[model samples]
Every structure is written in structure tokens, then in C-alpha cells.
Target: MTDPVDLFVIGGGVNGAGIARDAAGRGLSVILCEKDDLAQGTSSRSGKLVHGGLRYLEYYEFRLVREALIEREVLLNAAPHIIWPMRFVLPHSPDDRPAWLVRLGLFFYDHLGGRRKLPGTRTLDLRRDPEGAPIKDAYSKGFEYSDCWVDDARLVVLNAVDAAARGAEVLTRTACVSARRDGGLWRIEMRDGATGAMRTVTARALVNAAGPWVTDIIGRVTGTNSARNVRLVKGSHLIVQKFWDGPQAYLVQNTDKRVIFINPYEDDKALIGTTDIPYDGAPEKVVADEDEIAYLLAAVNRYFKVQLRSDDVLESFSGVRPLYDDGQGNPSAVTRDYVFDLDTGGGGEGGDGAPLLNVFGGKITTFRKLAEHALDRLGGRFPAMGNAWTSGAPLPGGDLPGADVPAFLNTLRTEYPWLPRKLAGHYTRLYGTRTREILGNAADLGDLGRQFGPLLFEAEAKFLRRTEWATCAEDVLRRRTKHALHMTKAERAAFADWFDNAAASHRREAAS
Candidate 1:
């Protein structure tokens, strides 16, 4: 066992990592444990957009939409490299929401939450505008709005990195087998996935930000009960080649009244998704079904001149959103807003017992705020804890001058003339100013070690494993970085083989 800390966070997703970072920065001791790699779950498998959820306005979630809209600019200012503005062209459908209603929503979207830095919504002429060229002429009008694109997986990793830098213990591939309250402190037991070794930790309070497994942690792990419940909603997406010519993305309303986003992804590809379905299966076992794939393709086909078929789906992924059950029957109707269930001793905040904070239904755009609110709930326990500090601070590597990505990229290239333009661009997008840490003093491409693909290099892999807690090949290929999406099957297999060997050798050396 070890000395008791101020907080113990159970999940390593965005919310959990964000909470860990926030608490640690507040002068509170914290330990954050994850069963798998950071963002190995729903955090990585998102539509990769940080938006205000324009459709939510129809549900009268003005507070949620306004908060999200405000956060959109805050996050973009915070992480300019990974989170930057993107234009979305919404092709109007006469059959669905009327043009007047659409215009009203855009008006509210522009004015709500004090919009700043991003362009306001504009009307598009589908018959003449360049953005509408890809649309079938049947739709003669559309609207364009601004939102931000994000590297969903990298966002989670950066939070974990910042938490560690702030003196918080981040354990990846380590599962919290059990956590129970004992004598006013919570005793937590964790088992390492690789060694099967168990370690005990005691914390003054616990946070169950377990995402899909929130209830599991409450009942099965902590042996406690809660009145709250989470409704599992499955959302799926498909990846295809960028079929049109433009930086702008497309938003089309389907016959079912749900909006589909077809966004430009990875320069040469497109990311189209997300089907909302009531999910009852295991969150880990979730996968995009054929029906969902067809549905997404059909939605795109309805507006675009380019015909998309099921075969055009290069990849598909699904994430089970643990939405707070709001007595809504439709999966899409469920509120994306978050809720907190704090369990202090005897159901009161002033009690001296260790508190367990359970987070429900939070999205990427509002993670920072969620963390601040979560900590505020436990202010009675720690009077000496510092005030909320994440809103003004930049995340790891997010401290760019003027939050300018283009200028930073140019500067990086000027400093390292040997770095290829594409490689430099990738490094800047993923690591921002921290690209120096990955490149080091080595002056040329040869110094980057072996080249796995155009973007995947041996030095970058080592950096991830060393600093970012990358345990296996997928951690780098899929989450910490997205080199897997660009490489061939054989190349991926070869890299995996090399990575496994390297990891085994490192283990042997450590044991010696």
C-alpha cells in the first residue's frame, strides 16, 4: 500500500484525464488508472469534430449548446494545431427541416455563447457556389457554418501527459480491479495487464469517470449503488477517400431528420459518420454494422453529386456513448449534456468520508469545464485546493504563439531544413511546439531512425513509448498517432513485428 492521496480517478478517457489534470494542478495528489491505453475506447472513436451540436437547439438544450459553443472557441484557442476551424456546408433539404427554421438555428448558433475567432454562418447557392459543386443540382441552396476538427485520440493522450507532468500518476494498461471505502479513505487495487502484478493505493476520494463502465465501477468495483443510470447509445462512422475537391465539409439532413457530417480527413480521405442507435451490447464489443454503413452512405449520396457505395467504405468504427438517461426513448433525443452524482458519506457533502464522484454524459468539447465542475463538487473536502486553472492554460504542446499552426509549421521547417515538408506538417499537427522533443538534436531524416511509412518513423515511436506511455504497436499506430491509416497492410504487420521485438528486448534489459 502507499500513502493516501487527494483523488483517485478510475477512467483515462477525456473526462477522466481532464479531471486528473485539473485536480493535480490544484495542488491535490492524484492517481489516474486505465484498463487499456488512453483513449483506446470511445474517446478515440469519435466523429473527430468539436462542435456545439447544432441540432440540440431543436431539443431546447440552449444551455448545453451555448456552453459547447463557447467552449469551441476556448478549445481552438488552447490547441490550435490539433483543433482548428473547418467550414461545414449544410445542404438544405426541402423535405426535412424548413429553410426558415434552419436559418433561425444558424442565427442563434452565430450569436450564442459569444462567438469569436470563427466565421459566422452564411447562405450557400448550391447552383453556383464552389462548395455546392459536389452537390446534386436538385438541392439549389445550402448553408455554411464553422466548427473545429480534432485528433480525438491525441487529445486524450495530451491530457494524460499534462496530468503526469503535474505530478499525477497515470497508469495505462492497468485495470482497477476493486475500490472500496475503508476507514474514511478509499482503498483501490489495480492489476497490471502485462505482469499480472497487483498494487494497492489509498486515496481520500475517488472519481468514477469510467464512461461506459460508470455503473460497473459503482456497483461491481466499489460495491456501492446509485440512483443514476446511463443509457448506451451507439454511434458509428465510415471513412472513405476524399471524393470532392475542397477543404470544406458537408452536412446533409437525412430522411430520418438526423444530420450527417461528411468531413475532409487526413488530407487524402473523408470521415463520414454517425448513426444513432439504442445499444444494448457490450461497449468494448461495439462495431459498425452493415446497416449503419449503408445508412451513412445513403445520407451522403442524397446530397452529393458523387455516388458513394458500401464498397467505398475504407473503414468503419462505432462508439457507445454513455448518455445520461433523460427518459427519452429515441437514442438521438437523449441529452449529450453531462450530469454528476457525488456520493459522499451519508449522502451529504459535509461528511468526512471519502467521496466518489460519478460523471455521466460528457463530450470532448466540454471536458475542461466538466473537470472544473467535478472538482467544485468536492470543494468542501479540500479547502486548501487551488481554484480552477485549466481554462486559461494551454494543454501539453498547445502553447503556440497567437495559437497559429501555419506560422509554427513554417518556423519548424526553417529550423530543421532536413525534415520533409509532409513530415514537418504531420509533426506540427500532432505535437505542435513539442516536435522538437521528437526530433531532438539529430539533423536529418537519417537521424529519425527507420522509416515505417511516410509519416511513421522509429524516433517518433520511441518518443511515444517513453513519454506518452505507449505500451504496444497500436498505441502509436492508432491512438498516440494515426500512422496506421496511411500505411499498407504489410507495412503495418512489419512495424508491429519490429515493435514487439523491441518491447521484448527492452523488458529483458530492464529485468537484467
Candidate 2:
């Protein structure tokens, strides 16, 4: 056991990491523990867009949509490299939704949260616009609107990185086995997944940001209960070779009234998802079943002229959304908005022992605001905590000149003339201002060390292992970077083999 810190956070997803970053910046001692890698769960499995849920207007979710719209710009400015503006082409159908309704939603989406940098909505004639080239002739009208794309897993890691830089302990592969209120602090016991080593700490407060397993954390880990609950809605996505020619993505409405996003992914592929079925199994065991795959493919086949087959699916993943249960029957209708349940240790509203703040539901777009609001709720507990500062602050490598990627790329190529445009572009998109950390003084491709895949190199792998706590090959391939998507199966196997040997050799060296 150690001296009591100000806060102990469970779960290392985006919400947990965001809260830890906020608290550490405020001078509060914090410990953020994760069972797996940083964003191995739902955080990494999102649709990978910082969107304002434009369809939510029909559900009368004005406040949620507005808040998310505002956050879209905030995140764009904060991390312009990974989070850049993308225009989504919605091929309209008379059967799905009225054009006027769609127009009104787009209008509200434009002005709802204060649009500044991104472009507003525009009508596109499918017969004339290049964006509609792939669409079927039946849909002659479409609406193009703006939303920001994100590197979801990286977003979580960056928050954790900033938090650690501000003096917070980040424990990956560490599970909080128990958290109990003792005296005025909450004692936390964690077990390492790799070595089964045990450690303990105490904190004045505990936060349950465990997304899908939040209830489990409350009932099993912390030995408590809340009046609220999370509805497990499984959303699945499919990865296929990019069939479209443009930089734009497609948002097609199914006959069922659900929308599926066909976003351009990994430069040469499309990420199409997501089915909203009620989930009842363990979150860890979730997978994209055949039915869900068929559903997604059918949605794509409805609008696009290119007919996609089951064999076209390169990869598929499913994530269970732990949405706040508001007694809604439809899984899609269940609120994407978040709710905080603060248990003041039975001392009533303001009264308290060691306060336990349980975060219920949240989306990727509004994670920062969620963190701010979470800290605000615990303001009374930590009277000495500093003011909120993440609003204007840039994430670790997000301090670009006017948030211009093309400009940054130009400067980078000028500095390292030998670096290939594609390689330089990869490093810039992923690492942003910190690309130098990977490049070092390397003059050419040979200096970058062994090539694992087209984009992967020995130097970049070493850098991730050294700084980003990347233990397994999947950590580097799937989550930290999407190199796995580009590599052949045999290539991925070879890379994983190399990773294991390298890691084992390092361990032996340390032991020696």
C-alpha cells in the first residue's frame, strides 16, 4: 500500500484516460489502471468519427447533438492530424426519409454547436456530382455534410500520455481487483495480467469509467450498486478494399431506418458498419457474426452501384456500446448521451465519505466535455484541484500551424527530402509534430531499420515499445497503428514472431 492519492481511476478506455488527464493536469495525484491495452475495448472499436449524431434530431436529442457538434470543432483544433474534417455523402431515398427532414437536420447540425472551421451542408445532384458516381441511379439527390474522422485508439493513448506527462501513474495490463472505502480514502488492489504481481494504492475518491463492464466494477470490484444501468448494444463493422475513388465517405440509410457509414479507411479500404443488436454475452467474447456482416453488406449494396460479396470482407469487428438505459425499447433509440452517478457514501447529495463517481454512457466526440463535467462533480472533494485547462490546450503532438496537415507535410518533406511521400504522410498522420521522435537522424529508408510491412519499420516499432507501452504485436499492429490491415496474413505472422522474440530477448537482457 502507498499514501493516499487524490483519485484512483478504473478502466483505461477514453473516458478513464480523459478523466485521468484532466485530474493530473489539475495537480491531483492519479492512478489509471487498465486490464488490457489502453483502448483494447469499445474505445478502439468505435465508428472512428467525431460526429454530432445528425440522425438524433428525429429522436428530439437537440442538447446532445449540439454539445457533440461543439466538441467536433474542439477535437478538430486539438488534434488536427488524426482528427480532420470529412464530408459524408448521404444518398437520399424517398422511402427512407423526407428531403426536408434531412435538410433541417443538416441545418441544425451546422449551427447547433457553432460551426466555424468546417464547411456547411450542400445539396448534390447525384447525376452530376462526382461524389455520387458510385451511387445507384435510383438516388438522384443527396446531402453532403461535415464531420471529423479520428484515430480512436490513438486518441485514448494520447490522453494517457498527456496524463502521465503531468505526473499520473498509468498501469496497462493491470486490473483493479478491489476498491473499498476505508477511513477517508478508497483502497485499491490491482493484479498484473502478465506476471500476476499484486500492488495496492489508496485514493480519496474512485471513478468507475469501465464502459461496458461498469456495472461489474460497481457490484463485483467495488461491492456497491447504483440505480442506473447500461444497455449492451452490439455495433459491428466490416473492412473491405476501398471501392470508391474519392476521399469522401458514404452514409447510407437502410430500409430499417438505421444508417450505416462506409468510410474510407487505411487509405485503400472502406470501414462499413454497424449493426445495433441487443447483446447479452461477455464483452470480451463479442465478435462480428455472419448475420451482422450480411446486414452491413446489404446496407452497402442498397445504395452503392458496386455489389459487395461476403468474400470481399477483409476483416470484421464488433463493439458493445454500453448506452445509458432510459427505458427505450429500440437499441438505436437508447441515448448516446452520458450520465454520472455519484454515490456520496450514503451521506446524501452534498454529504460524503469517500465519493465514488460512476460514469455510465459516453461517445467519442464528447469525451473531453465528459471529463470536464466529471471533474466538476468532484470539485468539492478536491478543493485544491486546478481549473479546467484542456479546452484550449493541444494534445501531445496536436500543436500544428493553424491545424494544417498539407502545410505540415510540405515542411516535413522539405526537411527530410529522402523520405518517401507515403511514409512521411503516415508518420505525420499518426505522430503529428512528434514525427521526429521516430525519424531521429535517419537519412534514408535503410536508417529506418527492417521493414515489417509497407508502412511498418524497425525504428517505429522500437519507438512505440519504448514510449507507448506497446507489449504485444497486436498492440503495435491493430491498435497503435493499422498496419495489420495492409499486411498479408503471412507477413503479419512474421512480424508477430519477430515482436515476441525481440520482447523476450529484452526481458532476458534486463534479467542478466
Return the top candidate by lDDT.
2
Model 2, residue pairs in steric clash:
none
Which tens-of-lDDT digit does each residue in 252-325 have in candidate 2? 89999999999999999999988999999999999999999999999999988999999999999999899999
**Candidate 1 to truth, TM:** 0.99
Model 1 pairs in collision:
none
Give me the displacement of residue 118 in model 2, in angstroms: 0.7
Q: Residue 459, candidate 1: how far off, in angstroms?
A: 0.6
Q: Which ten residues in a row have the lowest lDDT in candidate 1?
A: 344-353
RMSD of 2: 1.0
In every candidate, how many clashes are there? 0, 0
Provide the lDDT at 269 for model 1: 95
What's the C-alpha lDDT at position 363 in model 1?
89
Cα lDDT of candidate 2 equals 0.94
List the candidate 2 regions with Cα displacement exceeding 4 Å. none
